[model samples]
Each structure stands twice: as C-alpha cells, then as structure tokens.
Target: MATDVSNELDRADNVGRIVDSLDSRRVLLGALGLVGFVGLWWAGSTAQPEYILPSPLAVGLAAQSELASGTMQAALFNSVLHWLPGTVVGTTLGIATGVALGWSRFLDEALTPIVRVLRPVPPLALIGFAIAWFGIGHAGAAFIIAIGAFWINFYAAYGGVEGVSEDLLDVARSLGVQRQLGLIRTVVLPASLPEITTGIRTGIGRCWMLVVAAEIFGAPGIGRQIFRASNSLQVDRVIAYILVLSVMFLLVDTAFRVVQRRVLAWR
Candidate 1:
C-alpha cells in the first residue's frame, strides 16, 4: 500500500509538470505570434504612405505623447460617461421586458412580431432620432449606445427564459411554488443565468464599439479624437487612439470575466 501510494504521488507530480510546461509553451507561442504580426505591420507601413499606414513605432510614440498631454485620459473619461448609463439603462430594461415576454405566452405572441420588425433597424439609423430627442451631448451618444445594447440583451434574456426546462418548472409548481413570480425568481432566473450573462458580456463589448460611432457627431470621446486626428492626416495618432480603445476593451473584458467566473462558480 505504501509503494502504491508513492507511485500515484509520482504520477501526479509528473502530470502537473507536464501541464505547466504546456502552459508556458502556449504563452511563448502567443508572444512570438504577436511579434510576427508587428513585423508584418512594419513591412506594410514601409510599403505604403505614412498617412495611410503609420509604423508601429510611430503609433507608439503618438500614444506616449497623447498620454503625456492627458488628452487620452479626458477622452476615455468622456466615453465612460456615455457608455455606463446607456449600458445600464438598456440592459435593465431589456432584461425585464424580455423576461416578461418570455414568461407570458399571450405577451410573446402579441409582442414578438413588433420585436421582429424593430430588430432589423440599425442603431445608426436612429442617430437622427437620438440627436433630436437628446441633443448632441452625452445623452445623445448614450441613446445610440443604449439602442445597440437593448437589442443584444433583449434577445439574450428572451432566449434564456424560453429555453428554461418545462420539467423543472413543473417540479417547482408541484412543490408549492405555483406563483409565477416565485417560479421565475427561484427557478427560471437560475436556469437561464448562463445565457443572460453571455448576453451581458456581449453587450458590454458591443457598447464599447458603439461609443466611437455614438460620438461621431459633436460628442467628445475617443471617437472624436480619431476624427480630429484623421482630419489632419495624423495616421499615427489615429492608430494610437485605436490602440487605446483596444486596451480599454481588453481591461474591461478581463475584469468582467473574473466576475463572471465567480458568479457561475456553481457550474
């Protein structure tokens, strides 16, 4: 028994080492792939006009300058102002509305056609309405962002609720949980959490992209920074601003993933 235990311990240690080695290899390969991409981008930049394809070094320098001057910070702050309220409002409304429709057969039949008809309308088309309704400030930009988030979250919640197991719900009803609200609160929400969380994650990313489009008019954000840079043919600055958006997205997504893992730990 002692010898058998020793052999199992050795095997486990060997497996752990092998897993660590694989993880390190994956990290190294990812680094090399990023280097190769930068090399190709440098070659492309050399072949094209600087105004069209600024070199990575030049873009890095521009990013440094923007950071030193505090312009990027200001733009990022403005963007957050637009992004937060819009995402929250849209997400809350969408989830609530979708849950209602999904829970009620009568509402689903009566409202789904309207949803289908409205779903095809792009957020860009509503830019005019946003401006007219909220003016050309943060509210207007947020309206556009909200619209984009609304549809994404709406579909997610609707699908999640729709996909809840009938057997599970029936079991809950038989257990003296016949109230619709009680069933939804205790059973449906938990069952559909994964889909709802996925929708929320997707909406978060989508909303960031919309920030640029939302600020295209007169709103002050990273999108406006890009516009100003492009007008002067400041390709390096444009690329730098784009990198800023990429970095922000990565940071936010990473933070959210941590929360998601905790929330879904039971799974």
Candidate 2:
C-alpha cells in the first residue's frame, strides 16, 4: 500500500512539473502576443498610404537594400565604436563612485550635493561640451553616452548599497570580515546585486534612446542615416532604420536578461 501511494505521489509531482515548465504555455503565449502585435501593425499600415506607414515587408526590403549597399554596416560600426566606449567608461566610473559614497559617510556627504546638481542635466544639454572637447567625432558621441550611463549606474550602485539590511552587515561582522572591502564583498555587494542589475538594465535602454540623439550631433551613425534618408523623402529607409534600431535594442536587452539570469541563478 505504501509503495502504491508513493508511486501516485510521484506521478502527481511529475504532472505538476510538466504543467509548470517554461517552454510549454509560456512559449505559446509569447508567440501569440507577437502575432497579435504584428497583425495590428499590418492592419494599421493597410489603412494608411505606404509612404506614411510602410508595411513590414516594405521596411524589410529597405533593410535588405541598406545591407547590400553597406550603409547598415558603416552606420553600425560608427555607432558601436562610440556607444560601447561611453557605456564602459560610464558604468565603471558610476559603480565605483556609487560604492564609495555608499560605503563612506564622509564621501557621501561630500559628493551627494554635486551629483544631485549634475544628475538633472540632460545629455543633450552637454552636447556643446562634447563637441568642444571631442571634436564632433566618435569621441563626442561616446562622451554623450557616457554621461547618461554614468548616472544610471551611479544611482543603481548607491541605492543598492543603501537598501542592504543592517542585519546583513552584522552577519558579515560575525563572520570575522570587518574590513570595508570584506564587508562589501561578503555582504553589501551580494545583497545589492538585484538593484545594481536593475540599474544596468535600465541604463541599457536609456543609452539606446540617447544614441540617436547623440548621433544627430555630426556623428556618422544610424541617426545620421535616418536623417539623411529623410532629406530625400525616403520614408521607407527611415522606417527600415527605425526597425533596425528596435531590433538592436531588443537583442541587447535579451542578452542582458540572459547574463542577468545566469549571474543571479542563486536567487
């Protein structure tokens, strides 16, 4: 009788696991959502002139043409060279500054005022400085992106540390890790990871938005490509570039999610 009961329980657990599996209903639902979205877009385009609202196919064709002409490649390379450097510089500096401020009361008090004053200013507002300093090239574009990324990571790191529980610090102390660096590594850093990751993800999207604007400032990139297309009234190319930009951002977001899941697998 006990053997029979155990078999029944095991079968029930297996059934539950199958039902809760990720690729089952979740994949189906996600596919359905994409279909519905594209269907709505198709309907909307059908109701408008192709020039005003190009169909997905039209944009795809434009993308093909751009790729064939090497326009897409050049623009992508130009944008990447600057955007990547800026993000790296910004994220690194912001995290370091934020951690320092969070860990030390003196530093927090000394820096908070200046950070607050600068934080409200938009990257666009700093274009003059960027151009003056970097001479309207990749360096200028990178500087703009860096300014945006810095703030995001800074707040992420700062808030993550601030949000760590006092109990966690106590636990670290009890573990005989009383030094500041040890406390950060053993308690504060781990405890604050979720918030820090959130900040990085948020920054990724924000930086992409800024990319177009940053590129508009005499930089040779996707933004310039779109703008130049508009000069000749090539709305199809404009739409295609917009689609390309969306795809790029989506890819980055997906990659970040994958990395995030792996890093936070413990949770």
Candidate 3:
C-alpha cells in the first residue's frame, strides 16, 4: 500500500510539473504575440491620421484622462447595474426551463418546436421592443442582454440534461431515489453541472459583448462612452473604451474560471 501510494504521488508530481512548464511556455508565447500586435498597431498608427487611427500612447492618455475624471468609473458602475441582473436572471430561467424540457418528454415535445422558432431571433432585433417596453435605460439594456444569455445557457443546459447517463439514473432509482425532484437534485443536476457551467461561462462573455449593443439606444455604460466618443471623432477615446471593455471581459472571465475550477475540483 505504501509503495502504491508513493508511486501515485510521484506520478501526480510529474503531471503537475508538466502542466507548470506548459503554462510558462503559453505565457511566453502570449507575451510575444501581444508585443507583435502592439508593434503592428504602432506602425499602422504612424501611417494614419490621429482621427483615423490613434497611437497606443494617445489611447493610453485618453484612458488615463477618463479614469482621472471618474467618467470611466461611473460608466463601469452603470454597465454592471444591467449586466449583473441580466446575466443572473437569464441564466437562472434558462437553466430551469432547459432542465424541465430536457427531463420531461411532454415539455420537450410541446416546447421544442416553439424553441426552434424563437432560437434564431437575434437579440439586436429586440432593441425596438426594449425601447418601447423598458424605454431607453438600464432596464432596456438588461432585457437585450438577458435575451442573449438565455439562448446560450438554454442550449447548454438542455444538452447537458439530455446527455445524462441512463445507467446512472437507473442505479439511483435502484437505490430507492424515486422522487422526481429528489432524483434531479441528487443525480441529474450534479451530472449536468459541467455543461451548465460551460454555458454560464459562455453566456458571461456573450453578455459582455451585448453590453455595447444594449447601450446603443442611450443607456449609460462603456458602450455609451464609445458611441459618444465616436460621434465626436475622438478615436483615441474610442480605443480607450474598447480596451476597457477587453480588460473587463478578461477580469470577469479569469475570476469565473477560478471559481469554476474550484467547484469542479472533484473532476
């Protein structure tokens, strides 16, 4: 037993070392890619007018100014106001609805057709209804973002539930877990968690992209900042806000992935 345990530990240590080496190489390559991209951008900016393509330093200065003036902070706060609520509501409802439809033959039969029809409708197409219903504010922007998140999560959860092992469910039933809710809670949900989490991660990224579209009709956010700056020929400011959006997405994604790794540690 001791020999087996030592062998396992050694194998695990080797795997960890390999992973760390790969991660280090990945970081180095990523840094090189970023440097190449920045060099290209600098060369392009030097050839173009500032109004057409701002230099990296100009965009950085603009970002610093926005930060110093507190406009960026306010915009970030407002963006979060809608982004958070929309993502939460959409993810919750989508998972519930998807699980129901996937688990129940009747619901699947009744709703699959309707879902197929509605699935292709673009969230942007709802901007008019959002304006009319929620009226040019955070609520309206959230509605649009929710639509985007809903579809992504819905498909993810539905597929997850569908892919659950029949043998596992049968084993649970044989063990006296017969209640529908109990079966779902103990077996179905745990089995489907990976796909559901993947959906959530994807939904988060898509919703971030939708933030810009959501704010197209006059909501206050980074998207609004970009719009306003673009209209005034402020290319530097526009690039600055775009960078802000990129950084925010990276931060949120990194944070979520950390939590996801912890949650799925058993895997």
> Is 1 or 2 the stronger prediction by TM-score?
1
Please give the lDDT score for candidate 2. Answer: 0.87
lDDT of 3: 0.94
Each prediction's TM-score versus the true structure: 0.90, 0.88, 0.97
Error of 2 at 184 (Å): 1.9
**Which candidate would rank higher by lDDT, 1 or 2?**
1
lDDT on C-alpha atoms for all candidate structures: 0.92, 0.87, 0.94
Give the candidate number with the greatest TM-score.
3
Runs with alpha carbons beyond 4 Å of true place in candidate 1: 1-25
Candidate 2 structure quality by residue, lDDT tens digits, 1-267:
999999998998898798789657898999999999888888998999977777778778999999999999899888888878988898888888888898889999998889889989999999999999998988999999998989999989999999899987898799799688999888888888888888888888888777889988789998889989888878889988887778889999899999998999787
Q: Give the TM-score of candidate 3.
A: 0.97
Clashes of each: 0, 0, 0
| Candidate ordering by TM-score (highest first) | 3, 1, 2
lDDT of 3 by residue, 50-138 (tens): 99999999999999999999999999999999999989988988899889998999999999899999899999999999999999999
Q: What TM-score does prediction 1 earn? A: 0.90
Question: Which of candidates 2 and 3 is the stronger one according to TM-score?
Answer: 3
For model 3, the stretches where C-alpha displacement exceeds 4 angstroms are none
